[model samples]
Target: MPAVQETVDQVRRIDVDQYKYGFETKIESEKAPKGLSEDIVRFISSKKDEPAWMLEWRLEAYRRWLTMREPTWARVDYPKIDYQDYYYYSAPKRKPTLKSLDEVDPEILETYKKLGIPLREQEILAGVVREDGSTPSRVAVDAVFDSVSVATTFKEELKKAGVIFMPISEAIREHPDLVKKYLGSVVPVTDNFFATLNSAVFSDGSFVYVPPGVRCPMELSTYFRINERNTGQFERTLIIADKGSYVSYLEGCTAPMRDENQLHAAVVELIAHDDAEIKYSTVQNWYPGDAEGKGGIYNFVTKRGDCRGARSKISWTQVETGSAITWKYPSCILRGDNSRGEFYSIAISNGRQQVDSGTKMIHLGKNTTSRIISKGIAAGRSQNTYRGLVTAHRKASGARNFTNCDSLLVGDKCGAHTVPYLEAKNSSAVFEHEATTSKISEEMLFYCRQRGLSAEEATALVVNGFVRDVLQQLPMEFAVEAQKLISISLEGSVG
Candidate 1:
């Protein structure tokens, strides 16, 4: 019994240590005055060198935000956030624009190296070898430190394929027409509270454009890091896949361990034109606070995709493993005939974490289709909820929708809930819904132990299998990291 207990302790410690990216980068930053105000919003726009029209857009959003209230509809419970208490803008001190990987700051390069995200395309393609000498597949990455994009790898390679992949800040200056045409087209500035706030002060995120008939040669990705103390991160991502084009984009985020909670509000918009397809995947691993939930991040984000032309498709896959509180619903608007939308998610909460997430699919065109698969895992004293909606309008003749929500509870103190809403005005629309909740079975554990697996191993194995369906939807590089996160998140559930 003593030996078994010792093994359990060892496994828990190792699992906690797997969050190697949860460390701060010691870099100087220029921060705006702490708080939310008209001046602060203007300051952010001025700092970004945005055009006057853009500033007006932000001010409009700010005005709308003032009239709006923090939504309490989510099942998550957290202390009231002091909007004016944190720095709304923080960027690394002036540094030379990197012309090549060799010109990048060695410290920044080393930071990603530690996170297992290689900045060198050659090294990434050759494969990133772990300390154990195992190699993970190659991936291009845009590293965002605090509120700014520092470097984007494989830009030249992507350019040759007629893909435009760069920081949103750069896109605003180089391709204002494209930015103006679609910025907020999917999620308008009047959308919601958090999104309005983000629009007013968002610093930096990725911008991707896949030209017509050109499938992206490789996956494009962004790695966002938060380092400045008492600073809120507001990043905006915009992706436009032109007619007959295809692109898969991935996002990863992390923050240092802290005792005080930080705020992160972001907005992501995706546009798919006729016959185009876009796949977006995210692995969110921000610090989830200590065991007592003293410190962590409040993640509030608005993500939506618009299928504007016939036969377009957009899919969102996310694995939420961290954050003290998470409130997000990546949605889709199928406005074109025969368009399709999909949402696959795996939300795991442990150590007092709270997650309120799901998706919304609005079918407005003829014969549109949508699918939703959600898996929620709750351990320790955490709470996980799945909230979703599927709406088919009167014009959406022959529309079809299917939804499946599954929850897994690992301990008695944890909780899981599913809330789904469906609305169909069209008689021809077909909607199917299913849900199930289950606990780790003693029989399964006993069988695994008989097969020589430890209690902790058996529990982790079962949880992994439960989420295998959605995990398989993640990009290969992200899948590996997410698997580790799942195993680590379930550490203390077994006796």
Candidate 2:
């Protein structure tokens, strides 16, 4: 039998690319000038040639952001970020128009291959081959390398389905009507500090729209890798599900190893009209720095969905396991009658990582319902908290919400906290909030070991069982991988 340290060492040798879309596309980059003044913001807006109203929105956000202070309420501590230290836009300088998969740079393709991210529906669809001629996925993918969208797979097929999946920068040019009507509609520029900053200097991100009565035949996924050092990735993703439509979209992000923390403040908004459904999932695996937590990524994000029409539904499922400091809350505004909102999350923090994540459910219409299930795992001096809010307005008659928050502590030195606020004005509204905190039982580990499992294996099994409820909510493609991450994050922990 191999020694524990030796087995661990073998696993340690595995490259970072194992995480799907975890790739490095090293290319000479073009970037906006450092320091974000009004002129810099104007430069970004002008560079993208955004409409007048959008430009005005950016300026307004910049002004409001100046008045906002760096909030220090989080349990984590880090040096203040110098806005001048970052390049607003850093993209591959090449003007290659990769309308299809083949036009993408060979280097970018190779990077995705290392990350195990299938490029197109053909590649991942049903036996598409890579450069080496080996097959991986048949799923469609839009690979965003740095601040540019390099290649999109099966785009023509999606277009035939009346679906639009392109970069936000390209969308403003190609689908201006959709962009004009919906951009910043759900989450405005003045929403929050991070959102305001993202509004001012957003570089590039995906834009997706599924037409009415269309059940997108293919899954769409975006792979975002920020390779530029000292660059702030301000991406805005907008997803619109028209009446009687449905789409499942997934996003993943990763940054290069850096001693100085990089900033990733992205804004994602979803609009589901009458009888439409949108399912959004994210797996964020940014570098979490060293064991001593010298420096990594500060992931402050604002994500929300608006159930605009009766019977609309929006669901957010996230598996967060990385980042030195993670501050994100994906919320839903249930404004339509009988509209449904759901948030299922699994946040894992290890080795000095701190995560303050959860969801918000705002019921503003009659008969609205929401469900929230959160799982937090903390270890190794890390802190994980689930902060959620469920509110029912005065006219939101018959509003209902069910919340179950569970926290699992792997080590004594770590911390896990749950703060939930429930506000209901409608006498007909019904809300239930429940939470529990517990640690793994040594007897369970002993029982697993007695059944012929190793220590690591036993711990992995136990942790999986603990997160089983939340893991079950993930899509099949993501569940197995998320389970492995949860297990690996708690390795060697006994407390």
Candidate 3:
């Protein structure tokens, strides 16, 4: 008899739902229908019960965005985006004031449970279970899916330090005064094309404030996921560190695989007052379409920070690996005497993905200093670029800036580019920028493979080494997870 064959069929594996906070809510959400118009903008404002001034501000931004043209200079090719085809507002079908977590709807809790983020850390630690068995690690969390902020954990602990960590929606109703003062303070509404769109029809995001002389004890976090396909995600985040305060905030994003490309435009602003320090970190893993480049998200964002007072410090660290099109530059302004700024980033694009990103540092205060370190990795047939700017204004006496950017191409099919712009008008300013690009060497791979590692393992090892500098910059609790995410996202088609 011929040898019998054992066969296995490809199990159309439903998405693994790696992140515990992966479930969608059920409600008649408050949404501005698909389209962009003055009516839609006004509708969003009215939905939020925003005052008249905000409505006028949004109108101005919309007008500015109309005058601005879509930027085509990036080394990216994708279908043109339609601004009108997206919902300007999508909120959880809940009252304006569900003041407490327990007041949340049961459906919302189910969404959190499905995503592995339980309502309270204590509940999670007690092992939240279902008819089937699964749970997320007992970490304090705030889950934001699509356009709504679902849940937040560790609220009392954060509140004790005079820190406000909540969804922008709640903050709008509870702390509108603060939101009105600081919203769009750093990255103005007319900043860029996507920013104006975000301003006009922005949905919900995290809002954080650290009052004067307080030191935040725990890390503040926001987890964002895109659930609805064919929808654009426009979120706005504003963080303010009051005088003599300190805080460390982190945000992560992910999206599902869909056939049609989705647009994600967001704005993040950070402000640090005298003797304050604000550190912001992001690990973005949006769906990067597929190997054949069928679909993915277009990520265009504006992130900037202002060190508004003397001796303040601000730092930004990001690991970007998803999206069919990614274009952003998180920036910093040293406006006060002896202020400091730093940026460390690692961006990877695979398959047909494209990313053009980096940071900008402006020095205006006496003896202000800044540093920029960036690593770009390109794989498959993707295109990746590192574009940055470092400037020292005329009044920036004794200013100093150092920028180092490096690129690694994993295959012959991909392309990498670097464009760093530096301008210095101060006589006392000193700056240096060094950039280089190289392909991952086969010898390095061979050595790792000889040590009994699989191809994927070997590749991950080398790429990890290449990005070690940037990885080391992440917060301790998040560094390991971020590195693992980078490894998995950077694998495949390394030839």
User: lDDT for model 3, on a 0 to 1 scale?
Assistant: 0.80
Single out the weakest 10-residue window by summed lDDT for candidate 2: 15-24
Instruction: Give lDDT tens digits, candidate 2, residues 33-76.
Output: 88889998888887777778777878988999999877776566
- Superposed model 2: Cα runs more than 4 Å off: 1-25, 129-135, 491-495
**Full-model lDDT, candidate 2:** 0.81
CA-lDDT, candidates in order: 0.89, 0.81, 0.80
How do the residues 236-352 of candidate 3 rate in per-residue lDDT, one tens digit apiece?
899999999998888888776777888899999999999999999998888888877877789998999999999999999999988888998999999999999999999988888
Clashes of 2: 6
Model 3 bad stretches (over 4 Å): 1-30, 94-96, 99-119, 124-140
Maximum-lDDT candidate: 1
Provide C-alpha RMSD values for all models, in order.
3.4, 3.6, 5.8
TM-score-superior candidate, 1 or 2: 1
Question: How many clashes does each candidate structure show, in the order listed?
Answer: 0, 6, 4
RMSD after Cα superposition, model 1: 3.4
